[model samples]
Target: MSASTRSPKLRVATYNIRKSIGTDRRRRPERVLAVLRELDADVVAVQEVDRRFGDRSTALPPEVIAEETGYMPVRFGIRPESLGWHGNMLLVRRDTEVMSTQRIELPALEPRGAVLADLRVGGTAVRVIGMHLGLLGLWRKRQARAVLMCLEALEDPLPTVMMGDLNEWVMDGGCLKLFARHHHVAAPGPSFHSRRPMAALDRIITSLDLRVEAAGVHLSPKSRVASDHLPVWADIVPAGPTAAAERHHVAQSPLI
Candidate 1:
């Protein structure tokens, strides 16, 4: 396959919406959605999706998101009975069929969970896991531990990508080391504490075989403080000269 014929490229986004209550004290889901639309990503992982108790965030609903934007949403949470809505969500633009989806519940100061989606994009199947860790230290570490645990148990050899509001600005090599050699960190696009932002919390970490084509932070001027953290975007291709081969090697290779 020519370089162009290699794996299809994809742009992904990770955003933490602080329950749609922006600094302006207005609920602006459309503005927030507009910012996300600007990213032009094939998929997105969102945090702080307020509506745990089945309240509406905006005039638009999850089904409306698909109708308006053509991206399907997959969301999950551990708390079954909560007035406030909080959870992780995965939205995909292509015709995606979930191979499997799960919620990793964390024992943190506030309950949190993850949403994993297996997508079929351009005839290519890839796994994308979206998560939001707890705010407290002990809880965060446990959540991170759960992340590693999930990584180690992949049944398929196909490449995978994990993105979300990790809530950790400092990289101590613990979370960084979880990925294998072919897997690596993309650009260090800072995306946290959106108001007068100063730290890097939102991120996109991919398999070593993946290379970031373009990565950055995005905050719409029209976007109010619906969330504390801004959204991050990245366009990526499978990395390395043999990334395509490795991707196809799963069926023939013993590693699978």
Candidate 2:
């Protein structure tokens, strides 16, 4: 599509930094930031961003992120030293306006949570949810429902996008089925085990009001070493009037 005919697009990405520990078992926060720079996303959802010990300090320091990247961490006030709730973090470009932020607790065998932000990217208002689901299938399903419930309880229903390290190995079953019932689920590609990616554990899901123009797993030399899981990104825009009408029709149509 030509520039004039194409709608404005926002690039969103999700990466599980594994606490900035690379496949080499080295803690390299700068390497993670370098990979993020390569993606050049408008907003990024990062998982395992904090150390799991006492204080739970962020792996990527706010000052370092501000100085090295074009993005800033969305502050949720969950903890003074932590940049995210649980291990989920959201980073938006410096030009984006964060209207509100929320920390959502999910049902899991271990402690797991999600971060939500209402943002104005350029002139478009959007809602972004970043999460790291549990390892077990049952907990993942319950967590998916909890996230959806949180979204429904919100007042303003802006064009929504949820992206993260889902920890789900399958494509059609598990928690993905729950998300697919209400949203467009896109597993860009296999992003797990960056050395030899064979699992599509990273994903980006969008509401019907939005359209994904392009989505893929970012595979670069830096990305391969940045973490155990590769980053996934999607270029999304508001659905055109015709597309929106068709989506509404599909929603209203009876199941076969």
Candidate 3:
């Protein structure tokens, strides 16, 4: 697909797997993988990944997920606790090259954090950040603040694409504003309380600098039982340098 000067077309999504347990008293790997395949995201930020339980890392989470869905694992950051490796992960198309990646530990009741990955996709630099915040109210408030701090601390002002299981439920909340300054695209809809979704809890917001080429909430019958909350996502086409320069010229040049 040809990318325009303003935005490069891409498909991305976020999903929160509820520990892979579904209606069947079993963690059906096929079902889990199937749900993801349906979403069809070129890049994804997944939360609640179980790496190791009692001395064994999930032998093939990356490989299996990749093999089934074709999205390659770029980076995985396990939580501080060692018993079971529970944490966040970023996956991209196998063809995509990883430029850099890191874990961002935030202040909260639990050891919550985020993963910021710099990737080169088809000759374009895409900054992808995947984060899961605290569930508790007080802890979540603090965690939200910390999330804003991460955006403020970015090394470059280039357009950013963030995803993951952001624990916030309120649509008009302050956290949205923090992302707003960066130009998050309009939310597709809410994606929480999946058993019987009440409010649009799960969200897919993006930097205003990017365009919402496509967006949606995943709520398959299996996805609901797999996780308490549904996964929301957005396909973003970042504002390229050509567009940025034009905007700068508009800012500096007077009306003719």
| Among all candidates shown, the one with the greatest TM-score | 2
The predicted structure with the larger TM-score, 1 or 3, is 3
Q: Give the TM-score of candidate 3.
A: 0.80
- lDDT by residue for model 2 (1-256), tens: 3323434698999999999999999999999999999999989999999899899999999999999998899986467899888988998888788999999989877999999999988777899999999999999999999998898777666789999988898888899998988689987999989999999999999988898999999999999998999999999998878766765665554321
Can you write out model 3's per-residue Cα lDDT over 1-256, one digit (the tens) per residue? 3222323567777776656665444666577677777776767777766533454344236657757887777655443321122466776777777988767778875567777778877666778777777677666666666765676666565456777666666676646555554445457676766777766655565554567877878877767776666767677776667656654454343321
In candidate 2, stretches whose alpha carbon ends up further than 4 angstroms from where it belongs are 1-7, 242-256
- When 1 and 3 are scored with lDDT, the better candidate is 1
Residue-wise C-alpha lDDT for candidate 1, range 1-256, written one tens digit per residue:
3323535887788877666556676766766677667766778887766554444342235655765576767645444332112467777764656677766655567767676667766666777888877666666777766765665566664567888877766664434444333355664565666776777777787765677888888866743365677888888776765766665553343321
Q: How close to the true structure is residue 184 of candidate 1, measured as C-alpha lDDT?
A: 59
| Stronger candidate by lDDT (1 vs 2) | 2
Q: Model 1 misses residue 231 by how many Å?
A: 0.8
Candidate order by decreasing lDDT: 2, 1, 3
**lDDT agreement with native, every candidate:** 0.65, 0.89, 0.64
Error of 1 at 158 (Å): 2.4
> Candidate 2, which ten residues in sequence have the lowest lDDT sum?
247-256
> Which sequence of candidate numbers ranks them by TM-score, best first?
2, 3, 1
